[model samples]
Target: MSKDLEIGKKIKTIRKEKRLSQSKVVEKLIQKDINMSRETLSKIENNNRSISAIELKAISEVLNMEIGDFFDEEEPEDLVTFFRKRNFSKESLKEISKFQDMVRILLNHEKIYKGE
Candidate 1:
């Protein structure tokens, strides 16, 4: 598949995996001023339209994914790179890293159970 289509598919898959509806996802983006409609989301998921970087970034935040996650599906995100995306205080980073590590462990366990 084309890169655009691949990215779109990844977006759709992640959204579904999170059990999120298109309208719900769009609503989240709206809070970030993305101003996307459900139809736009459909077009994006179907690869009939393209997404801007800002839109993708906001989408990532709403989806609780790293921005790089969109461009590199199937790759594990580094905790440091993940933290750098947001401007948290140093003390916050330490706490966040611990939380993130716990989440990663759970995610990895799920992936293993799913035989991925």
Candidate 2:
């Protein structure tokens, strides 16, 4: 399959996994100053249309995902779902975010050390 088609499929998969409707995503996009229609989003998701970088970034934000996750073979765990499942308090969530940042930094350092 083409890269665009692959990306479109990933977007659709992530959106569905997040339990989000195309309309919901489009609404979020509009709040981000992106004027995409649900129909257009559907087209993009179905691989009938291509997505621009700006649209991809906006959609990623709406889906609460890092853009790089879309290109990965393994699906990322939905952090929102994780928090909801645990019923974490706001303070806990903030601490978790800080811990995640530290972990990310360590992973980056490891990659650099390994010359990856």
The TM-scores of all predictions, comma-separated, are 0.60, 0.61
Model 2 — which ten-residue stretch has the worst lDDT? Answer: 72-81
Which candidate number would show the highest lDDT if scored against the true structure? 2
Q: Residue 40 lDDT in model 2?
A: 96
Worst 10 residues of 1 by lDDT: 72-81
lDDT value for model 2: 0.89
Clashes of each: 0, 0
The 0-to-1 C-alpha lDDT of every candidate, in the order given, reads 0.89, 0.89
What does candidate 1's lDDT look like per residue over 94-113, in tens digits? 88788888988999999999
| Residue 4 lDDT (model 2) | 83
Candidate 2 Cα errors over 4 Å, as ranges: 73-116
lDDT of 2 by residue, 1-116 (tens): 78789889999999999999999999999999999999999999899999999999999999999988778575876464478579999888887777777888999999999999
